[model samples]
Target chain A: MAFDLTLLTGSGFWNPFFWLISIVVALILIYIIYAFGEKGYKRGTQQVKPFISGNPEPSKAGVHVRAGNLYWGYMDALKVYYAGLVPIHSGILTDYLLWLFSVAAILFVLVVLL
Target chain B: MITDFLLHHTPALLVAVPLLGAFLTPIIGRISPIVRKIWVMGTMTLTSAIAVLLVYLVYTRGTFVYVFGALTPGLAIPPDSGGIPIRIIFTVDPMGAFMDLIVAVVGFCVILYSLSGDEKRTGLHYFYTLFLLLITSVLGMVSTGDLFNFFVFIEISSLASAGLVAFSVEQGRAVEAGLKYFMISTMGGIFLLFAIGILYGQYNALNIAMIAERMQFTSLDKIALVLMVVALAMKCGAVPLHFWTPDAYSLAPSTITAMLVVVSQASLYGLFRFVFTLYNLTLNYVTIGWVIIILGVLSMVIGVTMAIPQKDVKRLMAYHAVSQTGYMLLGVGVGLAVLGNQAALDTYGFIAIEGGLFHIINHALYKGLLFLTAGAIIYRIGTRDLNKMGGLGHSMKYTMIFFMIGALAIAGIPPFNGFASKLLIYESVYLFNPLLAIIAMVVSILTLASFVKVFHSIFMGPTLPEYSKVREAPPAMLIGMGILAVLIIAFGFFPQLVVDSLVAPAAHALINQGSYISAILGGA
Candidate 1:
């Protein structure tokens, strides 16, 4: 039944069944490639060991990237933006209330004056 | 014999069953735990059945109204003051029925999750009671045709939800969160009440239909509009006014946080009702519409940026909730902006609102699923810190799968319900402004990037020594999350059917003010 359905947007349309077909084709091709490969592959073995330009892999704890470090470069680049943004969320109830009233006042002026 | 009566009084019964059940929950709890669980689930099941039947009836029968205190239940019997009905009314169009369906599905799933998740906590009876009451208020908010009744429902929702937010006595910050929510809600309520009073003063009516029919967009009306806009926007977590959202959402128990998503969208429904129905033709569409668009843009940009840096898993999801709300606002606001121009309205406006309405249901499903998964993780590890989690996919395989489904869906990846709706939004809203659409796409990328970080942190790497013993979430929780996951997948596959059957009629019902007013007052 889904094969007959097409979701129309204002600019274009989407057919999920087509996407499904593509994925199925892609998977079958990959499987065919896998069928011809050597059967000696083993997981978590020396075959899978990392050789990053002849440098040894770090310990597991060091190797496993923490959530903090996952986007460290991104965060560092945006520190100036976040410097002005994160402090807006001061975690103080009074400051939150102040922000609410300030927004309403600005809207009131905009709506009334415009 | 019984079916006809229920079919007739379905709207009233939908709200009444839950309100009565909520009060009776504590008494039933004294009997036995199993009986209480059965009672809560049964109440939600019946309410959901009624909601579905009402939605089906609306699609078939067109819009209808039921007067509470009238001599004839269907007719709007006038008081001695002549021709204007003074009783409370539940006038449900496809728009209201659409909202009711969202409330019903998410409400049942949340109740299912709460049963297993909070069974061991103290004062569990109160938790069920408050949850049922919150369901009652949301149903009432969406269905009521009276402005004053809408305000009453908002107050009831605020009281019940604030209590539930503070119900997690295990969390130290809950009381602070609840207190701040109460203060913020009370302030919003004052503005809403003031707006209602002004409208009642001008039109001599409390029913939204009557007032809408008699609307005069005067200076006073503009004042009331500003008050109502700001109040409802704050309630729904639009930017600069979204300060209370993260605190309230992250501190509530995970199941309750899931339900709170629907509640905030109820406020959004109220905002749409006010702008589209009450001030449809006469008001300045361009100015008011652009105002909403700006609010939505700011909310989308700010909410996601704040979400990317959070270490608390629940808090990050809470920020995403705010971010997602912006998409709905943007789509509908585009519809409103071009409402005056017939050419533009036909070109992209209707699809824009349909996209918004579609996203409302989609967000409720995936966001609810995501929160439940987070709750499952927290229930297992007794912590909310992402820095402290790892290798959960080894043991809690089902929850990991459910979380992946939700995370990908929320990021607007293809083959999920979120992409279907967001696609509608992006393609349609671009016709209005390319910059806004670009901003939305950039937000989607950031959402995906952040979620990749989350998945890698919690599910990848070797199993942590401390968490190696953590098992799967209980069966009831799994079933609850599974309900939403199946829905997300099905909606993904059937976007055309969903849009034609549900979203289009809802957008039509919202934009057609005459029909809403006529359902209560008289002729088309």
Candidate 2:
């Protein structure tokens, strides 16, 4: 039987054949593009070398970006939120247990009062 | 006849077979490492097959109770006793079968991955033994109908997982992580035991269905509910209480980390069982539901934000595990919020729960794949520092593809399992509250952004001189990851199949508690 999920709503997402056809069509289209595009490609030449703003390529190690520096702006903008969150994940067992207890206490109050 | 026996005794055997394998693993290992490896594989294969059979039996035969050491499965309550199940009971409802399927599938894959990934490690027998025992405990936790039995299983799982976490003695950090995990797990265990004790003291019964039938929702029951939910939320790595999750997940051997993800999901299963079945409609669900929802929102926001800044690849994935867990909580929490109101529940609650439940399986598959891939990178290059990993795509083509599949799946990209479930959550939760759904969408975007950073840092850059000699991961690891990747794609494309076969029956069994109680009481 098909998976209906009618209890959740009238929505159902069960057309495997549709997905199969779509994937086949997409792959064929991509294969056609690649087959046509390969005629202009050159191999084993200076033209194949990576260009960095028309400057000579630096050592790979020097140019490789590290994970720590990848999202500097995002971190800077969320500085205050991180300051609050990062400290709370303090890697201390005592603090972790404390948080567990605090949440329990808060939940207790809420469940009882409401 | 044999099939009948196995079907009748599936629940007990599911737990017992693994426990037996665990005890025999070290003895078998002493004979020969190869023999031990074969034995472990055989054991897990059998266990997984039995789990599948149990799910089939549950779906076809309906809910049933298996009383340990009893004359008959139906003899849960002693004739002398006042309708209380004195013996330990194993309730193989659809929900339990659902969790068993997850534990079995993931546990089998982890064992396959571990065969090669941890081949050279010392005390290999102990590792395999603890792994089997951990699986046993998880199965027990999901299947047991007795609250005290659940507590016992929780303790076993905690100890076994902690041992596995500390397996790499060379890494002092692994030992530290194990210690922290043990301490927090112990605290959670104590709270769990205390809550069980409260219920036992008040109702004089330890069986979940029994106590649920007699639920008074008294002051003590409220306290017990708080303690139980808090402890389980902590165990499952819910936010505000999820500090130990990253440390333990990052430090464990990659295969064990994959299994630990399932371990946490078992805890999540327990949380849902307590909320939906044990408490049912007796408690102030709206209040409890909002509390859970708030915890989920916190976990989602904090987990992804923290993951974005992490330099350690495994640690980043661990935080994402926490974030993915939040989606399950949010989906189920929405269901709980509208529990008693039939109109609201019929309108959106069931879908919300389905979304959460669907996410559970999807998360397990994709997260397990991600950890295995991370392990592969570490196995080849000897480091999890993303900065050090560059141009691995050149050497490890299959690994790159697997990682991409996992990355896209976890990021909720379409044509992946994560997207299917997240769609259900978004569309349904939006009806409940627009703001919640919007936050969920924002979290999904951030998850994608964080993983993009991971992908670019690890695979997209120029080939580094340091990793020039690094080769592809071994075939066994690839096969393990391949299984999960294939399943992820299949589930993504055919979500309706998964929903019909697994999620719907499981969600219905969970939300319908009367059937659970009646299975034991014989419709009394």
Chain B TM-score in each of the candidates? 0.99, 0.99
DockQ scores of the candidates: 0.60, 0.52
RMSD of each: 2.0, 2.0
Q: For candidate 2, lDDT tens digit of each residue in B176-261? A: 99999999999999999999999999999999898999999999999999999998999899998899999999999999999999
Off by over 4 Å in 2: A3-40, A51-55
Q: Highest DockQ among the candidates is held by which one? A: 1
Error of 2 at B137 (Å): 0.3
Docking class of 2: medium
RMSD after Cα superposition, model 2: 2.0
Taking all chains together, each candidate's TM-score versus the true structure is 0.97, 0.96
lDDT of 2 by residue, A1-114 (tens): 864422223344434455568889999999999888757567987768897898987898888887878889999998998998788788988888888888887887888655
In Å, residue B307's CA in model 1 sits off its true spot by 0.8
Fnat computed for model 2 = 0.61
> What local lDDT does model 1 show for residue B140?
97
For lDDT, the strongest prediction is 1
